[model samples]
Target: MKQIRNFCVIAHIDHGKSTLSDRLLEYTKTIADREMQDQALDNMDLERERGITIKSHAIQMYYDRPSDGKQYTFNLIDTPGHVDFSYEVSRSIAACEGALLLVDASQGIQAQTISNLYLAIDHDLEIIPILNKVDMESAMIDEVSDQIIDLIGCEKEDIVLASGKTGLGVPDIMEAIVERIPAPEGDPGAPLQALIFDSVFNAYRGVIAYFRILNGTMRKGDLVRFVNTGKEYEADEIGVLKMTQHPKDKLEAGNVGYIITGIKESKEIKVGDTITTVERPCEKAIQGFEDVKPMVFAGIFPLDNDDFEDLRDSLEKLQLNDASLVFEPETSAALGFGFRCGFLGMLHLEIVQERLYREFDMDVITTVPNVSYNLMDKSGEEYTVRTPSELPEQHTIEMVEEPYITAQIITKPEFIGTIMTLCMEKRGTLTKQHYLTPERVELSFDLPLAEIVFDFYDRLKSVSRGYASFDYQPIEYRETDLVKLDIRLNGEPVDALSALVHRSKAEAFGRQICKKLKELLPRQQFVIAIQAAVGAKVIARETISALRKDVTAKCYGGDITRKRKLLEKQKAGKRRMRQFGKVEVPQKAFLDVLKL
Candidate 1:
């Protein structure tokens, strides 16, 4: 255990975490020369295509210490840098004893860097500050070094200046990992207590759970039990994770590896569950592991209604891999039977939708995304509303409280004016502002979660010219004047098209949706009335004219009364059709409204 070092590489997005990981792997000779690739730990195709690490990948490396000429075992976990996947980072941190806090030389310290640093501190993990991209022409080495000192309060010489692309300072980083990071402390002879941090599903091998052993040793063919499910199974295989799974007879405490129990059902293995021997189980399960809190809610419905069961199964298997995703069955008048799904953000939702299509061959339609709300009725009964259609009647509701977040934005000083204007337009109140340096500024705000759900990030990037980094955390639910805005086709309301919005912006928002619907909805035999309403009042309206058949074209040579009679008959027919005619809304219409 003294020679074992377990740590992870954490940083903001595109701050050279993966690149540095690649350099380290090469330096340690973990992969062969021909097998090397960019972002080598990111095995998923989607992750490579998007240039982001969507999943946390763990691998074992062997390094030789120069001082004592002793071989050491290093377990390195590479984590995603995006704010949406912070849960993955937390899980990785929980399984490690230290972290490499990488900062970009050009970008300095951003919002996500600060947030992830706090997570490491909360876990009591040792922090190693490293400055990456020092070889770039625009690298602000001195300024960024000072910023890192201010952030972590470490000495000047303790920070490692490295260039991931050029492979500079790679040996120094390895030496620091061996010297600075503390070894894992556990009793190998005690009862086995392993924390399952992540797992994956395979058709041929069944479910493979990746865990960190904290107490005792686990051997192959041992009778093991999952504490959460209370089910026992013989360990089919035990192995360490390299580029591939290297089968082994035993893995001792203070190491990371995988175990296969031949459990076919995905639901049987939970991500945060504990694993132990059936004969001598641990006294208690691990604590401080919290459930994932989804920031956005949307309905995921199958393109074909009969594929509902298939969708459910697909989601179940997907959930096993993505522990953050949550869903329950629901039905919509406009879209039919579907499941209301919760996601960390819009990008996470899109990635899940894309994965379902590619991995499971399940094509799905996702409704407009919205945040959950807390509602109180006149009788003092409170309800948690996820979808707009789930809101109670207007009169019966007493007060509505919406979730708010503390938004932290780090950007250049020159763009502060435009960024402040954008936030104010989104109904955000400025809470605090300070300068990290003369060139870099950090602004904090109290904003409703719903306000930033759609296009706030995109607009922030545009306004700051891609120089801004943003991060947020949920604060509390506050009372607000919220109204349910409904879209009516002809006279009936479409439950899927309803939304809960602030009263101040309801009228303008409704008008925008009404206009977008007018362009997307097709014309029918009768004129279609599209109205956006709040309770009994219609705030916006749009009409699509009918495709007339020219019923009076042949009566031009006859008496004026004949033409009048024909026109009257046509008008009556149209009125009757308008009352009973149903408007067919295309799938594009539901998705297009979110663009507004």
Candidate 2:
């Protein structure tokens, strides 16, 4: 146990965490020199292309320290860097005794860096602050070290300097892992208790669960069962990830490994569930494990109706690996039958959408991401709406509440005014601000989740000149004067083009959406009336004129009365067609409204 160290690497998005993991794998010889690649832990193609980590990967390495000439078992779990995957980092942290708090020397502290540090602290895991990217000419190791000292209340010397890109200080990092981070604490003689931090589905191997054995030993032939599910399965194989899965005889206390159960369904082995021997099941399950609830909702529809079942199967398979993803059947007049899916955040939704197309080869159309809203009626009825189309009329609703978030943005002092203006336009209220350095500032605000779910992030990046980093946490739902703005085409409501807006800006929002719709919707033979309405009253209107033709162009010598009659006849035909014609709205129209 003393020689065994279980730890995970955590950091903000794109803070060289993946780069550090790659170097660590190389340092431990987990992968051969020929097999090494950039961001090796991010095995998914989308992950590599996007330069992000979407999954947590675990690897086992044997390091022999020269000082003691003793071999130590190192379980290094690489965590996702994006905030959407924070749940992955949380579970990885829970399954480890320490965390490698890697931060970029060039970027200093970021929005997610603070959040991840606090999560590790809350889990009571030892955090080893390491300054990375120090090999770059632009790196400011001295200044970054000072920020670390101020944040963690440690001396400058306590901060470790490393560069994953150049492989500098890699050896020191490994030695620090052995010397600074404590090994797992548990008795081998105690009842079998293991924490199933992650699980995956393999068509050939059935469900494979990766866990840290907290107590006792799990052998290859043991009969294991999940304490939460009470379903027993024969443990067919015990293995560890050495770049790839390598079979092992047994996983003992203070060690991390994977178990291959005969259970074919991945859902049978839940993340955060305890694994114990069925013959001698643990008397009590581990505490503090709770189910994950999705924080964002979006509608996903297949581009072709024939692919509906395929999309569903894809979502089910994805949910097996990602338990946080939730979905149910949904239908839309504009998009057709689809699923309303719930996700951890916007990035999660984007990844899932991309995977649906890339992995499954299914063409999908995703609606605008929306947050849950709590609504009340005059009759004291309560309801929750996940999309703008689900919102009720203003007259029937007695009170309206929206989910707000505690947002933090870190940027240069010069960009504070631009950021503040952007936030104010989104109806954000200033909470507090702190000057981190003479040239940098940290601004905090309470912003509605709806306001930022769309293009707010992109706008923030633009206004800050790509120098700002932002993060948010959901706050309580509060009462507000809100109204549902619905778009009607030719006196018929289009539920796909609806939004919930504040009463003060409802008219402006209506006008803006109407204008965008005009550009997106295709012109027809008959003029289409596009109106943005609040219940029965229309607040904004835009017209797509019918295609006009010169009716008298061929009649050069005709009477003036005959030409006028010909024009009048043409106008009457258009009026009749406008009343009865069915307009075809292109898919781009729905997308334009979502982007708006």
Give the root-mean-square deviation of each candidate in angstroms: 1.6, 2.2
Q: lDDT per model, in order? A: 0.92, 0.85
Best by TM-score: 1
Residue 38 C-alpha lDDT in model 2: 95
| lDDT by residue (tens digit), candidate 2, 28-139 | 7878999889988877899899898898888888898989999998998888877788888888888888999988989899888898889899888888999999988989
How well is each residue in 489-531 modelled by candidate 1, as lDDT tens digits? Answer: 9978988788888999899989998899999998888999899
Once superposed on the true structure, which residue ranges of model 2 sit more than 4 Å away at CA? 549-570
Structure candidate 2, residue pairs in collision: none
Most accurate candidate by lDDT: 1
Q: List residue ranges in candidate 1 displaced over 4 A.
A: 551-568
Worst 10 residues of 2 by lDDT: 261-270
